[model samples]
Target: MSRFKRGAHVDSRAGFRQEKEDCPVPYGLLKAARKSGQLKSIRAVLMYLGSVPHSVWRLNIDTPQEAQQNLSFGAADLTKLLLSSNKLQSLSEDVKLLPSLVVLDIHDNQLSSLPDSIRDLEQLQKLILSHNKLTQLPSGLWRLTNLRCLHLQQNLIEQIPQDSGQLVHLDDLDLSNNHLMDIPESLANLKNLVALNLSCNKLKSLPPAISEMKNLRMLDCSRNQIESIPPVLAQMESLEQLYLRHNKLRFLPELHCCKTLKELHCGNNQIEVLEADHLKHLSALSFLALRDNKVKNLPEEITLLQGLEHLDLTNNDISSLPCGLGTLPKLKSLALEGNPLRTIRRDLLTKGTGELLKYLRSRIQEEPKTAMTLPSQAKINVHAIKTLKTLDYSEMNKTHQDKSMTTNRGCCRKATKMEEILLGESFLSFDLCKYRMLAFIKIKRGLFRFP
Candidate 1:
């Protein structure tokens, strides 16, 4: 009963005729989709390749069937097509008709394979096909040299072709949550890549060549079976944040050259010991997460990270903390929960960082200072030794007086530098008897003279 829509002409045989601007090759695709009952639940909500001018076309296919049956893009060129979350089981090869496409995002679809003709979109720059059922990528995908961001996460993808090195312009590449066993070393050729995500995969180790990605700023290889990281990764000049959580690492590699690294997350591992040499070089580290590990103690060198703001040592075997930990000027959050601390009261830990730090400082102040006693043969200068006022030699054991006098002569006759010491506040003036005794026996040191 309703006359043909705006762009449609009445066709006696095919029932509906599209506008002349529509490509004939893609027109047959619509007819095939209609015949297969693919268009039964979806309205005529598709854009055929038109002229080469209108570049930004977004076909938001997530709408209900009541969506507009026909929408006008005004211009003809189709440069961006976003059909994300569509129930599209297959994409027609006629997609090649849109030669001007620069961004093609069909994420959240059921597409198992892409048409080889996808290579025809030479102008493509950003391609997102994440959350799909794709087991392998098409060879045509690797030839897109202009791509800057390629997201293929949350898919069943098992491998990436070596031809991926051709995307030298990629800045962000997310291949996380896939079945990838390992990455190709050729990925190092992406010298301009800034962020890379390889989480939740079946990878046991990473290619050492990954350290060659000079401009990579973020590298996430979490939730894998990686037992260790390539030591050369510490040489990446631009790397700032590294994530290796939920793995089987027995020890953290010594990152001696990662000067720009700021955040390191290596939780849930078998790391039992944190060596001072391996951790002290992260000079710029601000956030360090060592939770759920077998760590028995934290190295005192960890306090050398003067810029550190947060430290997580949860669920470890640490029984005592380094006293210097409370001296970090910028430390704001210190997490020591679930550790076997024997000295710190559990209630004091719950009192917040300010109170906990106050307690650590109180302990520092309460600690007894070890006295420094000079040996019997050491020389002493009576003038330099400020604490010596009087000493009682009359009460000395008569048997040892000769030995004591001989030892005291050697200790004072050649008076040298005296060690500064804390003196008791018992007396003020030097006793005359002490002066007399010092002049009498050459009991030469003030330490042996008796009052």
Candidate 2:
């Protein structure tokens, strides 16, 4: 017989016995046997060791009976514990028994508060309590300096303790979907933070100290009642993605230092002007959204964005566009719908972005060069005057003294008719002798004086 078959009838309280149906093996002896390598068969070893201390533990004890039966294990060796999607109204103080615990996830529960004994877990690194009914965080949470990720989103958190910045090593934080109206200034102490989400809140403004997060890459403060953003936002050199949609801002902040920014979403606001100073520094921008604003004109400097791919300007008051907009090479998605554009035909817009861009380029080519045009009523013609060699007033029937004062009366008669057709009959009564003397003196000298 196999060793597993021999140990099948072992009792729980007794040591390994011979031919006994009621007596079972002791737990301590089975453990010792497994430790000394006496248990050779894998089946026998599994049958002997049913539940033991592991580095990771997960339990779904929603009922009272299941909680009492399943949660009674020794957690001295546990490093991670997940009890999500349960009816856990509260956590027991016994959680402090797990000294080596590093991660605890109890999201999607009815947890309203955490026990103060949670501070005893000195090695805890991540605490995920999102989608809970937590109204306030315990004061002991700040003691977890080693914590790197803390998610308290979708909760009823009304305020964050000022000392919350004690978690200096935290990298990712999500406090969205809360009722917070303000934040603590000490939050700037989290120098290692990378991503911060404070969206879907009632915040009116952000602390000025928030600009101190030098390593931050992404920031989402959308869907709030914020009236203005701090100018210090331009100082975040490492910021790549910024979201400020659905706010009450009246203008865009000058982003002269945000050179690494890639995506900026500031749609659904009350912005009226987009100046050159607001766009000159965003050299690395790719996506810009300014939909549903009151902007009337886009500055000619907008073509400076060489890498821009998507530009959304729907429902604006813009009536014209700069011709340079057609020269951008990388623009692929341009949304000008719901605008009051009068120059571009509606049919052309319906044809899509390609046709619209082609039309703008054609307009650039069709524009005429700078030149002064004369009216049709003016019969004066100056094209025949090859260098102003003669000054002839035909109505007066006389010609000025030219290169050697040749008195060619017949040629002078033809010049009189041409002058009448050019200068009109208004010069008939003008004094020709005085003007002729002035012209001869001017031609003789290098300087010509205009009367």
Candidate 3:
């Protein structure tokens, strides 16, 4: 005969029955309980559903029926399931009952391994198992053919099973912060893989079979000990973005045929040379980062990359430049900080790319005689014999010289004017005439010198 502790009703707008904010309860359930004479049953059910578990169920009072009734439904069709930071040592066997799960985020758990029952979730797409103590993946996980994204980052995984290639449909795989020494050849079977992040691992070299993944667009192998890039990887047609930062690479990958490449980041490596053919083939490339490498020179052929937009050569040993580099049509952002380039102007060190280009153009134009040499040569008679060293100023005179006039007469007139200028006391120095005569004799010998 215990009376049920019925709390005050809650207002929808104000959230309390008295509008003064007291502990709120539902009015509909309380009204139904009073009419059915089950007020105590309703209160116990509400309390059990709303309260968190304090301890193991008191068997004397809490029956199996009460515990089973506490389970909440309607969370089954949820796409994202987060069970992180929980005291869960193992996933519940009942999680397999959720049929509509897509993303299973259970990071920061004490799970040493995953239950094989999870493989039954055919609709599950992304599986995040980070920060767990899993030393290996379950063999049954290879059966999830529909999985497109798998994140096993920050785990205790030391080796990838050879059967990892079974994930043919996976497009993204993140195994960063692991203890792997080599990538399994089975990974090449993931033909649809667009992004593969193996950063912060202990890998020493990449497998040649990696070129088999034709759809790979982004690859991050940063912070590893990779010493060489396999030449076979150059044939990967769809590879667009590559990250090999902080590695021990001494030379760039021979990715000459990878035309779709857009960004290549190999910063903090030991690369020494960049090939001219490498730059010429990357027609679609926009960003190139070779910062903190051992590169010494840039080939003039680098200007062939008309689509290049951002170039970062910071902290390298570069000391000069190919003069034609400034003529690149699409080059916008150029970071040359910390390099010892001798050709770059001191005043233009802090200038923008446009101003730098303008300065370069002005310099090219300042030498007008040198710049006009090609066009002047185009107008000159190549077949002319007895070539005149002096430019003809008498041609503009109104009276045309008769062809029959003797050439000796013209030579005597020119030599008489030159002799007067040379013998004058007003001359800067008398020895200058001897030097001029020797220079003219040398020029005459060179003009008639036969091979």
Best by lDDT: 1
Model 3: per-residue Cα lDDT over 311-330, one tens digit each: 88999999976655677778
Estimate, for each residue in 9-67, the C-alpha lDDT of model 2 and write its tens digit: 75585655543233334445333332342321223322333322121111111122323
What number of backbone clashes does candidate 1 have, counting pairs of residues 3 or more apart or in separate chains?
1
- Ranking of predictions according to TM-score: 1, 2, 3
Assess each prediction's global lDDT (C-alpha) against the native. Answer: 0.71, 0.70, 0.67
Candidate 3, position 25, lDDT: 38
| Residue runs of model 2 more than 4 Å from their true location after superposition | 1-76, 368-451
Error of 3 at 130 (Å): 2.4
- TM per candidate comes to 0.68, 0.66, 0.65
**Which TM-score value belongs to model 2?**
0.66
Candidate 1 ranges beyond 4 A from true positions: 1-76, 368-451
Q: List the residue pairs that clash in candidate 1.
A: 54-77
| Cα shift from native, residue 96, model 1 (Å) | 1.4
| Model 1 agreement with the true structure over 49-110: per-residue lDDT tens digits | 32211112121122222234564322234566666766667777777766777778888877
